[model samples]
Target: MFDIPQLDLKGKVSDAEWQTRVDLAACYRLVAMHGWDDLIYTHISARIPDSEHLLINAFGLAFDEITASNLVKIDFQGNIIDENCPFEINPAGFTIHSAIHEVRHDAMCVLHLHTNETIAVASLEQGLLPLSQYAMFALASMSYHEYEGLAVNPAEKLRLQQDLGMKNFMLLRNHGGLTVGKTIGDAFMHMYDLTRACQIQLQIQGSGQPAVLVDQEIVDGIRAQANIVHTGLTGGQKSWPAMLRKVYRTDPHFAR
Candidate 1:
């Protein structure tokens, strides 16, 4: 469907980088499968292990079209590291991911999407109410960033970092949602909880009925409870394999 050239990096790159590429590619496919992709707009980025360079989608390819080797590698300044890569990344798209990646060393993967439900919830003054169990997980470590037109300015990076602080989830007011995790799976899981919370919130509001919010105590303690439930195996680590399986069943070429 697309005229993008294919490059095989399986043997060309280190085993660790190859794994990151495959996982990031699978993450893109999963986002598309969930109908959360905004064409080629939003980005999901992964830091190259033990390196300053990161991997992101080659700008023009749709989520489903992304393959492991086709992912673009770049430095913190958004310069494409591979001269042979026939794709140019969207500078504006990288602005948000780059900002977060710069300050959050623990954030190995950063996922951002512009789903309608997230935009609606973020636009509200209340912002991500603890109305569902999903919301509780999100509210446990959520932050909000006021939309500042397009996030193209380098100056905006500092403010975004400051607003995000140590939070894993961020609702970009009137914009979209962003999640950062120590791994690609963790980032995807965070997005899942956040997107579902917004979807449920919209459904309840649209019904025009009074909504029941979760207790503040429960919301406050959700992290500890989640830790126990996911004990030796975190939610993402457990669920990611299933996610990979589903994606593979759909089309295994994402790993390329």
Candidate 2:
């Protein structure tokens, strides 16, 4: 009988925002379970409702090992709210995530992963080619940012934002992949799509098979379809808490 520290969410957060955190956190663990986590390197963030702050995982914690209580409340400047989780914020993580949060108000959740395929694809001279329907959606909505070492410098934020304008997705050249969604579900879904697209692109590149980039018309159509994503992740309307339940099944310390 292990006791998990579940967030009551009865008063602190609007019902929607609390659930977004839970689902966004779940998506983090799911990323780990799917072998997408790089120890403490990558990050997932969910914008706090009625506020400019976001719920981000404490730096140094592995994604799968993250829990709701372990999450940190950080403002756009990376100033952490005085809370229970004892850890320093990853300035670089905040630098990258906060930039998106400031501009993409629609982005309720943001996910950035350094999956191997993503890194390989990022390093490629030709980034994210439109080969499949997924690629079409990706290339249509995705933006590109050149890497300037670890994303800590404030100077890089404007450039990063410039590259990520309006699109909500980006391939950080020579780095990895990033996705911002109106909901945690949408962000997670976008990550899955971009990750798969990168994998296929890398595999195709390896095979030296000529990738049949989808037609421009089809690419535009795919973008239109992607726009239609009904993000159930709308502030944890039904996601984060459910995933937390799964974490509880494993161990409840995360909520503490």
Candidate 3:
């Protein structure tokens, strides 16, 4: 039931664009592997290198069903850019992703997901507390955007861009979570940290025990500490290769 025709874009597009497609498709499969996908609802989008065109999954396909060649390419205005690409993108996905891409040139990939943990945390008044080491990574660069319905309104684009200004991690109030990165792996890792933070928070809350919050001093210095921990490897460059290997081991067809 998940069979999707391969467009065999290996040679049809620029080498960089093709690589972006493969990585973006890997991101989707990784999300699925982690049980983070909300069916075909949330989106993970990547910018084609040196181009305004963006890549997103076709609206009707589930995350596990996504493949490199099946992803639809579209412009800022949500117009399909791939010739005879028999697929359409989600308008809400375009609205959220395009708003961020238009303003944050550094954000080559924008990953959004509707995981229950994130939604629950975002709905709370506190919104992602400093309860765990995972939370510190997100808190170091977090932003929150109050939910405004379904995010399809063009008028909300400016507001989203403003709310997410220069922040890599975002919690959409009453909705889900979003992360931006200089590459697909960076975006995936950001979401990974955020999701874990939310998951830990909910577990503590459910336990009915007092949560030990991370010290403000440590939280404030997390960015520098993260650099030290990663040892100058920024933007998930250090971890992405391992992530790609895991995805490839699971299914190599995502690169098609």
Candidate 4:
């Protein structure tokens, strides 16, 4: 078995919530390793599995450095309940994440990022085109939101929620990408596939050559296939545990 290094997150959260924190923390690290994490600005959140509130990264920690015990727990109002750490949580990021968690009853985890490819693709007038197999699934259920500065205004939440309407994937125009899932596994998987799809599209576009696109009818079929509801809700149960094991090998504190 592969072992992961442990990074200490000083706190005393429960076992289940701690597990969520660990997986989310690993997501931050893995995203950084994949070049998807953008400094400390973007955020990833999980809905504490059974709670209405969310578990999100503290604003100051680099994605690669976050650990479970360090994750901040806050209500929908953004009030922090776990206070062992002094890091600030991003209010704007929460506004975006909270809106989704509030409306999307099925969503358990929400991951947001401003990766270069995601932003570049979002900026394009065409958006994420169906040039790859992954794109077919990505574009099928994706929503687009026109940029409105830094997403700081409370009024924008309404439009953001409206734009996201029923779709699990969103492209923040001129901004970046956001994915929601009923579980960390699902959201992460969506992001993993979606990010790679965007990277592939952007790379192909840079070639300045026309690329073949997928058929719309087929694209819809793929969405139906990818829908995890028909599947099971333990989104990251299989692979994420493996990732946790990897992270734990180096240091076991992620479960703290």
- Name the best candidate (by TM-score): 1
CA shift of 125, model 4, Å: 0.8
Q: What is candidate 4's lDDT per residue for 1-256, written digit by digit as tens?
A: 4333343544455667776777787777777767788787899998886687688887877776777867788999888975544666898898899988888888888889998878999999989998998787678779999999987888888898899999988999999999987678778878877899998998898899988888788888875675464374343554576766676776554456
Q: Residues 128-230, candidate 3: write the lDDT tens digits.
A: 9999999999999999999899989999999999999999999999999999999899999999999999999999999998878888899999999888988
Each candidate's root-mean-square deviation in Å? Answer: 1.0, 4.1, 1.1, 4.6
Give TM per candidate: 0.98, 0.85, 0.97, 0.87
Residue pairs in clash, model 3: none
Candidate 4: give the clashing pairs: 4-246, 4-247, 4-249, 4-250, 5-250, 5-251, 6-250, 6-251, 185-235, 185-236
Superior candidate under lDDT, 1 versus 4: 1
What is the per-residue lDDT of model 1 for residues 63-96, given as tens digits with 9 covering 90 to 100? 9999999999999999999988899998877898
Candidate 3 vs candidate 4: the lDDT winner is: 3
lDDT of each: 0.93, 0.77, 0.94, 0.80
lDDT of 2 at 256: 37
- The TM-score ranking, best first, is 1, 3, 4, 2
TM-score, candidate 3, is: 0.97
Per-residue C-alpha lDDT of model 2 across residues 221-256, encoded as one tens digit per residue: 764464355342342344545655776676555443
Give me the overall lDDT of model 2: 0.77
Superposed model 2: Cα runs more than 4 Å off:
1-17, 226-256
lDDT of 1: 0.93
Instruction: Pick the winner on TM-score between candidates 2 and 3.
Output: 3
Report the lDDT of model 1 for residue 202: 95
